[model samples]
Target: MNKSYDLIAVSPHPDDAEIGCGGTLALLSEMGYRIAIVDLTNGEPTPFNDNPQVRIDESLKAANILGIERVTLDLPNRELLDNIEARMKLAKVFRKMRPKIVIGMQGMTPKASPDHYQSQLIFDASVFYSRLSKWEHLFDGMKPWRIHHIFYYYTARELFTQAQPMQFTINISKHFETKKKALLAYESQFRAHPSYNPPIIEWIEGMGRYFGSLVGCAYAEIFYGSTILELNLFKQILG
Candidate 1:
């Protein structure tokens, strides 16, 4: 049997998870939840870097910093499509890992790579595909296992996107530094990248601060849920 995880985040590239929900992942790990990140692509051939191994090593280092496991799919970067093959590949991982919660990338980024939106579609289809019975052949003989929850983390690239009324913000105030370190691990993309004018790190930190303010925390991340969330009591809202 494949190793099980309590949660899994589907990322379009190596740094996508770190950018979207790294602090939350770090906090969850500290809470003792078994979590992993599945990167759809290696995030290669950028303007500043051409060596794929560098990106791979960086991703592993970031995963280590976050106290989580990392799995990089062989899917093509910059050319990711929401097709059957892509869906099957991810569905296989969902079947094997058997995550109770699957967090995926949300929103479209017209200024960034189109892979983000495609990855979202793939994540959606793969979630459904993972629960289909008698499709063992398609998933390498793995048995059907339904994921109980699904959520979305923003890429921080959508300019005018607004959070839904049911959307929730996770307080990552304690683990905010850990999230910064995890992002710094990808030096090739962040600190060393020349084309980023206003500096990417600052932009990310600004988003964190903005979200944190919403929840009255030092730092937080926003997530969208597929279903309505239930509160046990009125006091739960106080947090």
Candidate 2:
């Protein structure tokens, strides 16, 4: 079944999307938007998680909570690189999904994991490469696809010290609990981590509330745009 998506979020690891934009995803899903998440890595080789399959299972559970499809690539965790090969692999998925909006990681996190930055670069290139018609041979005969919009989500490990101002925010006050439940699906990473501190769910909710406060909402998720977004009417801004 070749399914199309309205939005596709590219995650650096299995749980990155759930941590970064689960609330917005949940709200979008409720609005009847078809959304998918492509995980660049399986997020294995962690201190507590021994079975890679278990992580895949957990990601599926989380995806179900958000009501979106999830795809995991074979890119190695902690060693993601933004190279031609990686970009081509991702381009194939972009062509297949043909999403209108593509969401990815913010590229300027110098203190966070290198995989975060590399994933950003890979997505930036892959989105562009997906529109190149001459890459048919390299991309398994997938047709060219040009996405309309690209946005970046903030990760849990991300520090706000160097945060870029969000261009827009989604009010997820109604779906905030659903986001927490989706994140809790990754018990191996958050619940069982040997050095787990600052309980993850609480922190996620706090951040959501803080961002919501900026927009005068109860809970919200922030996004950084790659280009200026077009507004059709004044009511859109009023909301």
Candidate 3:
């Protein structure tokens, strides 16, 4: 039997999850969740961050900093939509990973990038596809995989907020610094340009603190989910 993962973070852009949910991922991984990451794009042809191979290297660096096994689709930089072809390709990943939980990046909708839109499609599709009684080929008959939960992390600042309605607010103060360290691994992206980069890691820490303040912690990782989280008798949200 495949060892089920406790959480999976899906990111459309290179630094997105690192910015948005890095604290959560770090905390979960530390809590012994078999965390996995899927990056849909390779960060190529970017105006300031070009270089395909270089981008992949930097992504791997960031993943290593988080100690995550990242699966990059290596799709085109700014385009990752779904048609028969993209869905079919993603189906292959769903077949292989068999994640028990999935998370995706959120969007402002109609005002998001094609990559973000496609990532959302992939999120919903993969969640459904994993649980189907009959998927279209590539595997044996009646291979069904149901994920226990789905989360969409903030990416589109317009719709999601630094102080938005959150499904679950996890305290990741201990791991916030860890997340910052991992984000710094992607130096070529955030530390590369003159006018582009924000103090990526510090900025994320500040966001964490803001969310943490909402829940009486020094840091928190906000999450939006599809289903009501299962809370144990201890009142901690069950993984």
Candidate that would win on TM-score? 1
- What TM-score quantifies how close candidate 1 is to the native fold? 0.95
lDDT (10s digit) by residue, model 2, range 48-167: 889999899999999999998889999989899999988988988999989999999775556656888889899999999999988788877888999878888887455442455446
Q: What lDDT does model 2 reach? A: 0.86
Clashes of each: 0, 0, 0
Candidate 3, pairs of clashing residues: none
Give one digit per residue, the lDDT tens place, for model 3 in 138-215: 445436667777778875344533233447777888887778887777767777874675655566767788889998
Clashing pairs in 1: none
Error of 2 at 158 (Å): 4.0
Candidate 1 CA-lDDT value: 0.89
- For residues 83-112, write the lDDT of model 1, one tens digit per residue: 999999999999999999999998788888
List candidate 3 stretches off by more than 4 Å. 109-112, 139-142, 159-166, 230-239
Model 3 residue 63 lDDT score = 78
| Model 3 TM-score on a 0 to 1 scale | 0.85
Give the range where candidate 3 is weakest over 10 consecutive residues by summed lDDT: 156-165
Better candidate by lDDT, 1 or 2: 1
| Model 2 lDDT-worst window of ten | 157-166
